[model samples]
Target: MSKETRLREEIVTVGRSLHMRGLSPGSSGNISARLDDGWLLTPTNACLGELDPGDIAKLDWEGNHLAGKPASKEAFLHHAVYAGREDSGAIVHLHCTHSAAVSCLDCLDPHSALPPLTPYFVMRVGRLPLVPYHRPGDPRLGEAISGLVGKHSAVLLANHGPLVSGKTLEAAGYAIEELEETAKLFLLLRQQPVRLLDEEQIEELRQTFGAQW
Candidate 1:
């Protein structure tokens, strides 16, 4: 298969996986992958469970929609991150239950929302920051994400959900899942005494795993 064809099929496959896993439901998320010319994004208002590979939207680096369905309005947010982080080849934004629940809680440190609970969470998703709430598709949301994308590969949108970028689509998908599960753990263990990874431990993970600490 051609590169474009492979990417299209991969997008559909990942979308279906995410939907079936309950990470994204009811058209409440968007997925995109960087392309040679620009990128491919899930269509606006399209359910992840029902995406057609051929109907995924395509755009130039300039953000002009070139083919297939109309692109998600949050495509700009993906673009902003790609522009800032050359290593990011794919992005996944989802309003998963646990992560969104964490986003709604008060007094979260804007710098690092989820503490490093498990080694896998630290390895897969390093230092997730929190973005102030903005209405869905608000242009300012892109700006907010852009400001922090260079420093963080993942961020939780306050009162919204998590946005994660990775070197590949699978990496992005897995990272978001880790973030969601970690968020769930955080909530479950909030009242109990927990052992979080210390600074030295986090640094060790970063050095060993090459996480974007």
Candidate 2:
């Protein structure tokens, strides 16, 4: 199969895996992968659980639709990240339950990293910044993401969900899964005295594993 065809199949596989675990519901998420000439994205309003490899959309870096199907309306967010991070090979944006719930809370620190609750959470997903609320498809959301994505591999969209980029689609998916689970843990422990990983430990993970923050 051609490289494009292989990417399509990979997207479908990952989408199915996420949907099966309820990370993506209805048509509420989009996945994209970088390509030589452009990038591939899930079609608009397409359910992650039922994506067809042939129906995935491809668009140039400038956001022009090249083939397949109508691109997701939030394609610009993916484009913005790609423009800033050359190492990001795939991105996954999802309205995951726990992460979206955390996004709605007013306690989030807009400028700081998400609380480092667990070792894997810190290792898989490094510093996660919160983007100020913007209407879906607003260019400003893309701008907010672009401003931070260079330094941070992930950002949580206020009142929406999490946008995560990785060196590969599988890596992106794993990071988001870790993020969502961490959000769940935070909610569960909000009333208790929570212990976070110290700065020293986080730095160790960064130096040891090349963790992004």
Error of 1 at 167 (Å): 0.6
Q: After superposing candidate 1 on the true structure, give the runs of residues whose Cα lies further than 4 Å from its correct spot.
A: none
lDDT score for residue 55 of model 1: 98
- Compose the digit string of candidate 1's lDDT tens values, residues 140-187: 999998889998999999999999999999999999999999999999
Query: Candidate 2, which segments miss by more than 4 Å at Cα?
Result: none
lDDT of 2 by residue, 1-213 (tens): 888899899999999999999999999999999999999999999999999998999999777889999999999999999999999999999999999999999987887536988889888888889999999989888887888988888999999999999999999999999999999998899889988999898899889988654
Task: Quote the positional error of residue 153 for candidate 1 in Å.
Answer: 0.5
